[model samples]
Target: MAKLDFHIVNRIRAQVARLGDRAALRHQAAGQWLDISWREFGAQIHQLALALAGQGLKVQDKVAIFSNNMPRWTIADFATLYNRCVTVPIYPTNTPQQAAYILNDADVRVLFVGEQAQHDAALALADDCPQLERIVVMDESVVLADHPLVCHYRDFIDTYAPQADVAVLARRLDEIRMDDLLTLIYTSGTTGTPKGVMLDYANVASQIESHDQKLALDEGDTSLCFLPLSHVFERAWTFYVLHRGGINCYLSDTNQLKTALPAVKPNVMAAVPRVYEKIYSAVHDKVSRAPLHRKVMFTWAVNMGARMALARQECRPPSWLLQKSYNLADKLVLSKLRDLLGGNIKFMPCGGAKLDESIGRFFHAIGINVKLGYGMTETTATVSCWDDQCFNPDSIGMPMPGAEVKIGENNEILVRGPMVMRGYYNMPEETAKNFTADGFLKTGDAGHFDEHGNLFITDRIKELMKTSGGKYIAPQVIEGAIGKDHFIEQIAVIADTRKFVSALIVPCFETLEAHARELNIKYQDRLELIKHTQIIELIEKRVVELQKDLARFEQVKKFTLLPKAFSMDQGELTPTQKLRRKVIQDRYHQQIEEMYEESHKRSPRPH
Candidate 1:
């Protein structure tokens, strides 16, 4: 292995040296937030690395972390890297069968699990996974099986750290190479079986350097980590935060974000677009129901904030009158909007799915920088992102510095840079097929760059749907538009081989239920409520308004309101919350067929 000085382990080690007493990690337990100082972070990783070494793990050995976002998860990640072993992260929400697939595929020797569910799942798979040797449960309260392989995290570290020779870990760290495989992140598998994307230290190092140039993060920054660490987006960002000596505040449960945001008051964070969309929808929903005078004031304030935001985007100062109006707007309305997101957001990196332009603009108008970007797991999280100034909400911004992006055949976005993954692990044929003869990685996404270098994604090449009438439709565009409504929670568009676009929608029950009370629409349960004629009309009205800009063929002509949201448990969504389209289509085949069948029964309508 060729040696490298600027690897992740060494970077964190340097941070420990420079910022010993400062908090490197933070997490909530019981009712209080706790900090892990840089010194403590380094020490825990050292102990864990020695412990892993004592377990007979060698260089390139695969170690899996099956856990939620917590301090231990990060520690285990860095510790695995410190041993020069490949770290594989399993989504904490994965079923036992799913978890077993990754463990057996990677030949994972040691599995670190987080709560009782993960621990139980690991134990169930141990006998089937012949190569698996140990299970370290991070949560102490998890009841262990009567198996010799099972051990508490505390016991594992304490027993093995002293027995292991420190020199072995040192030598392994010294042997660290830029080309050494750092991680094997499995794709979300929206289309098919998940493939392990092989990313090396060079991929990560390149990302750090690129982000340093495009974004700003200093030692004083605090980033709230709520996205699943199993996903490359959050994992890479977390590493970058630590690399910059910034504190990473881990929120194990996203539901507690309501309280955690105010408590932690993090200045920087990264999240999928869904989080921002939900916040935007909720805020607007409340404002729409406010008193008439309050609504008028909000409209005026938003207009002033928008003017200021536009001036900033154009690299010009707002006029004196506009500046005063913006100052008043900031104090009365915009500041309150910012408070919803902790009131100290320097910028939030948004990815994973297309963000609605309206939602993006709203965040900018309210002085919250939601930097929408585009990327995938194979690219190590970010391919392109908006800079601090001069951004178009409709575009994904320019490519990262040192990264080359070109539109290939059929408008596929081709990338060639250090951030590109080495290949799909153990799948040479798959890797070979994905890369061009010229070495550029086929991104499988269709997009074009604007004159100003901003990349705008049109659609996933594989996901585009063609109707019976031969009109092509982008499902995400329709879903993104309608999904932004306050009453809509989740949506899946169905147009392939159909007469016209249709959708399966899951309403925001809380907001819908409140609206039902206002309308005096009484129901015993969600199913009955969604079936109400008035309720259906209410949703249909919003859908019609949202789709006004879409082509007639692209518009959702028919829809069914579902009582329940698409969930991971039902295999309807991936761990990262991306829709498993085939699964959704297959599971709701009857509902989908009815929408088409009902259309055939209707009176002939204009195209």
Candidate 2:
């Protein structure tokens, strides 16, 4: 294959000339949607590049973006790239200490923050991180502190951009190399301190080529940038969208995704499995309460849709009778479901966690293509994704065109590709340990390929639990099954070296409260509500039903319900919403112990 142009700055320049006045980015503010044209986007990147250069930021200097999803995030990202500087992103939900660790570790000279919260966090870190020289606030309405380092974004650009030499910035862009560090994305640190994954322009460039070959994105397509740009999944997709000349509508507040979906009417987007799972649960919960006739109609429509979807997966045409049924089904029920997701979805890429197979199949059955893929920050987002013709809900789809994947010792998924990261920044020993003697990156995930070449992930090798009876269990598989219940919000399985499996569960309070009301159960607060025998019984019944397919030894024998959800702020969840198993086990140690003690008292040698 021929070498691809990996220079991002040149791509933006070419896009500016080609797209001219077309909308390149969009954002919602003050109850209205706003558009930033390609020309405007290019100009902003140029100005910010010049401003950073004027601030004495030299080549390869690290810059940090501590913001939620917004158009300016991408502007700052490209600006840093144009100046040949490495960009480091900090999750907006990260606490002050977490954000400070990234800043100090990356030696970030300039920090771009989103709102007052991030601004305040950065202000608090001023005394701790001495290398942080400048703070540029993205939201103009945020009140600044009296510190000399802080400046509003408008003034920052207006003051420095004009004085800086544009020719010098352009010269640096022209000198771009494939090995230039594109970004340093710190891991969520589920187990320990976050490590900076070093990704370069070559990694990103290969992703662009692979996605272009697999996905059906077009120049006129629009994408909803729903996931945080701090995550590699969204960041890579955003770059690809720009490369394809697609419009990227940024949603700063993720809580507004339900409202924004219809408002934006995006053609393509990328999101984690949690988003799809919630939507799937909500739709089903609503349908379960509908009138009998409506319920019958929904069931029939879904069955018909499923038949059509299966036919397509087999690369066969549906029969005339089935086609007619599906058309009517689409009009009556499926289309309404699709409308909730903007109704114009060409495809929505899902990753970051394993999507429940039922939820994956349901979305595809309703004509909303949810392409389940797999990857990590180290792989620059996508190792494999479902193409148009590949539609197996049980698999993570085929490997990328230029990537090599195989099962190594212990069934670990090993990968060697141009898209793989350089290594962990400043962690030479850790990097050396991750790669094998011949250079395949040990992914730590256990999976296997089917006869058709589809990859099916089994479990995380490090997370597998071994019972005292010598039974090995995959926690994610059990968690994925039980977590699909509408009454459950989050779960963490605890069974490593134990005689039986147990879990810490957080209920979907909204659904639980509604059920409580129906049952005439009274409670003063969430804590009281969870302790009610009727509430516990309700959850226990659901758990038993959901885990019926699992082996007797692998089922969750006991569970404790918490009033609150696992959260990033609490260190119980990663920024991507993955449970930090160790943190949860440590925090709920007593509750877990009590469950096992009670089980032992009931049956001394249980299981």
Candidate 3:
């Protein structure tokens, strides 16, 4: 049976239809209010979908969408899926070249862009990409000029669009089969060119079911989205919000999340570790500058949080003494933290990157539910997610229903389920290689399942390095360890055919600033600040602290902290913020060599 589900969207239409003036979408445009209803939303999507079809767009064709999260973005995406065409999403921050590659790889037939920068990128490739026949500008207010390839989104909809007739559209929807390929997302491969991971409609449908079962979704649930909808993790969550009948209030941008959160007043969120890290930093910064009484109280509460986090990480119940201390602290101290989150926040599901275990536990201690999850694009973005009822701070929790997770011979996590991707698109050999003959998707991550079937990700296979001296080490291990230091914001370890281990770091600028203030030192920029003898010594001391538990050969011999932070736009980081070690090494080969040479010079001579 080919069953089509209205899922979350259908329920919203039924309830809100009774209220004649209720708004389904609220937009603040140029400081003016814009309200849309279920009727208008449906009409807009139906018109857009029909327009696309009228323009010779066929089922299974790739339609490229490049934009930030917006109301139109979701409407356009759902319409594309409804028409049985695939949607390839490009991140807003992607450079022209990166955008071109994804467009070309997918053989995109029509492009819908949100801004001028994205339009310029698409225009740059118009001559080269034969498959790209049309360009629809989402921000139609921009002048299209005389570009033959460009088309205004609203104009196209009105001109050639068929009048939306819902009954007719439902029949067209029947053409979409469950197993048909629906989308292709590129995994930001660390070593080589990023590969496109193909996912089918069934994969998405099953994932929706899994989330609906696991998450405590209620009729009142809503999401304030800031994470790039282009990402598999975020996109999947967005779809689930629609499926669960939850309202999605798209944030303008990640930078504006703090201001936007209060306005949207979301009940639930799924975000990456960096988002939580920023929140933690913001709180810590405030505490550092608070009045004496408030500072003392904040510090005391934070101490209790730290201890509670440690207990959760170690899977130990808090001692009665500690529980009493934390409970009393929460009422007077931690309650204020909730107020900052608009006092309505419920679940903040963290994924995309491994969160520092302590960070997750700290949030839990403060009565904030920050559950963690584990997945790669290969696993359709979620293998396991923390179950609140049976929460374990150290584990990624049990696999979602119908998803099979097993440890392979090499201790690599193997997954098999409807959520597993069809394989890398147009790369048969590569696809064949990624799976075992028995057909499990071999995730290139190193990890194991616990006795209770909770999953843990230990390291990445590709991140494991072998030195020229024949010593092997997991760079992820060293990087993860270094990242735990309060002074380091980001860390990337290097040991690929090199004599020993080294690291590239981006320091905590706020911490550095405070340290400089205490020492009566002044620096104009991060570059100058990093070169200070005091700062270098502090970081070196931290490296030594992390090395205490590591094998001598795996220890960091020397390090360098960059002036600026790593960024996706700069090509230093993937969309997911994973360090591109090869790119970093090549960009600073001489600096790394100098650090290593300086390391030996600083060592005492052997008698």
- Tens-digit lDDT track of model 1 for 1-607: 1225458888998899999999999988789999999999999999899999998898999999999889999999999999999999999999888989998999999999999889888888888899998999998789988998899999999888888888999998877888999999998788877899999999999888888888878886999999999999999999899988899999989999988999999899898989988998899899989999999999999889888888887888889999999999999999999998898899999999888888888889999988887888999989998877887768998899888999999999999999999999999999999999999999988999988889999988988999999988999998998999999999999999998888999999999999999999989999999988888888888888888998888888888889999999999999888899999999999988888885555311222
Pick the winner on lDDT between candidates 2 and 3: 2
**Residue-wise C-alpha lDDT for candidate 3, range 139-217, written one tens digit per residue:** 8666675688788888878765765554445655755577767788877666687688898877877787787778876
In candidate 1 the C-alpha lDDT for residue 595 amounts to 83
lDDT of each: 0.90, 0.89, 0.76
- The parts of candidate 1 lying over 4 Å away from their true place are 1-3, 598-607
* Most lDDT-accurate candidate: 1
- Name the candidate, 1 or 3, with the larger TM-score value: 1
Q: Candidate 3 — what's its lDDT?
A: 0.76
- lDDT order of candidates, top first: 1, 2, 3
Runs of candidate 3 with Cα error greater than 4 angstroms are 1-3, 6-28, 31-35, 163-170, 285-296, 302-327, 546-551, 598-607
